[model samples]
Target: MKVVETIKAVRNEVIAAKQTGFSIGFVPTMGYLHEGHVSLIEAARKDHDFVVLSIFVNPLQFGPNEDLDRYPRDFQRDEKIAQKAGVDVIFYPSVHEMYPTNMPMSIHVTSGVDVLCGSSRPGHFDGVATVVMKLLQIVQPNEAYFGQKDAQQLAIIMNMVEAFNVPVNIHGCPTVREEDGLAKSSRNVYLTNEDRAEAPFLYEALKEGANLILSGETRRSVILAELENRLGTGSGRIDYVDVLRYPSLEQSEQLSGKVILAVAYFYKNARLIDNYIVDIQEGEK
Candidate 1:
């Protein structure tokens, strides 16, 4: 219920909770709160004694032509949603609060920036990894929650934790969707009525592609082609349709084990993404 914009204030609350032997859960997000964001908060609250939700719209994670200036913000709405979801603290920091200095070293993402969303948006994941690291350090939570809708970003963060030996645990919660199958996102507001009607096909395409994988179709190129074909039936522009190993995110001609069938599509005004994660056994697929 408490909202604090200063680092000192947030640390004071978290430190006090730590001293009390209460486990901390942190959900870092930009301001707009949807069912997907609520799912992350609920997951954090389910197992942790205290939950801290940070709503800082990070500048580093945005591209020069991206919707940084126009990205949605509704503090009162977000506050109500977080509070209702059992959030204990809302770290509402400003850009200056998070980045006071002029310039400094950033965590340049070397490995996982070559594909998916990262492929088109250069330096995007670097910003994501940096801000996530910053938030993790600031909150010092026992566990942090993120949505699997951003499958590549989630994978990068999970890898960042292991590679850097960060103390906090990164949990990838399921992607919440609408009744019609569109993934929940802040940018969903940008869709026109026509685009909105056509949007659910992206998820359908991903689901169909996942079915191919589950039904003993192991060829990565075949799955990718089928996904693209399915998405091609829609009116939206196809950004990327790929199938890569989960967490590792490496491509394979013959996929084995857990892999994500993901797609990104551009509506007239909005870019939407959805994915299906499936595990393949050695002989089964």
Candidate 2:
């Protein structure tokens, strides 16, 4: 696999690939590669003629008090994983290379930015949208792959693409989880042994909430309360547990259409999030 650190070089390569009629698939990540990230790359490899994986820890997407400085990263390890997953190019740009001097303006998907992780983190999704927009513009891939693990992020990116008329297909892959049921995340490395043991409860709680809704419960309050109660036993603090309409991500009061059951919490010093979607059955009023 070829690794290019400069935007000019990467863009030139992409341009050349496009001239050859290669459909590029892009996967933007912050390094610290794991099965979750690999899953995204693998999916992109299968669908596109050329795959580009970016490994820049976007400072804009991280809050001031967040784990930006300590966020896990190992480029050598990540490159190997990407190559094994059939990645054609790895864009390992530095912060300076991305931002440069006098980098003005940012992109924000206003609607979905005020809820869930967006509301909690403050400017998190704006950073996300901005960086993603930049990447989309720079890479100019035919399609981009994102994991459903960041359900809100996925929603916000799709919203930005639609609202801004960016011409790239956004594909959301299934959430990859650990053997113990904890959704895989780069932040999972921050968890203490005890915290790791308790982390799986987040998914368990989300599953229980979906089960409650599927078993004929329509009261949003009751479903959320039950999920909170279940997650309370974990060592971390529960940030939020919400059920919302699938792609739009508006809060849902009933299990109709594509509904998502999502949760976020803190384990040790790391913040984690997970979600699942359930299609309401027909004639289930």
- The number of the candidate with the highest TM-score is 1
**Model 1: per-residue lDDT, tens digit, 101-137?**
9548999898867989999898899999999999999
lDDT of 2 at 211: 81
How far does residue 152 in candidate 1 sit from its true spot (Å)?
A: 0.7
> In model 1, what is the error at residue 2, expressed in angstroms?
0.4
Candidate 1 vs. true structure, TM-score: 0.98
- Residue pair clashes in candidate 2: none
How big is the positional error of residue 230 in model 2, measured in Å on the Cα after superposition? Answer: 0.5
Locate the minimum summed-lDDT window of 10 residues in model 2: 276-285
lDDT tens per residue, model 2, 83-192: 99999999999999999975578875668666678778998898889999999999999999999889999988888999999999999999999998999988888889
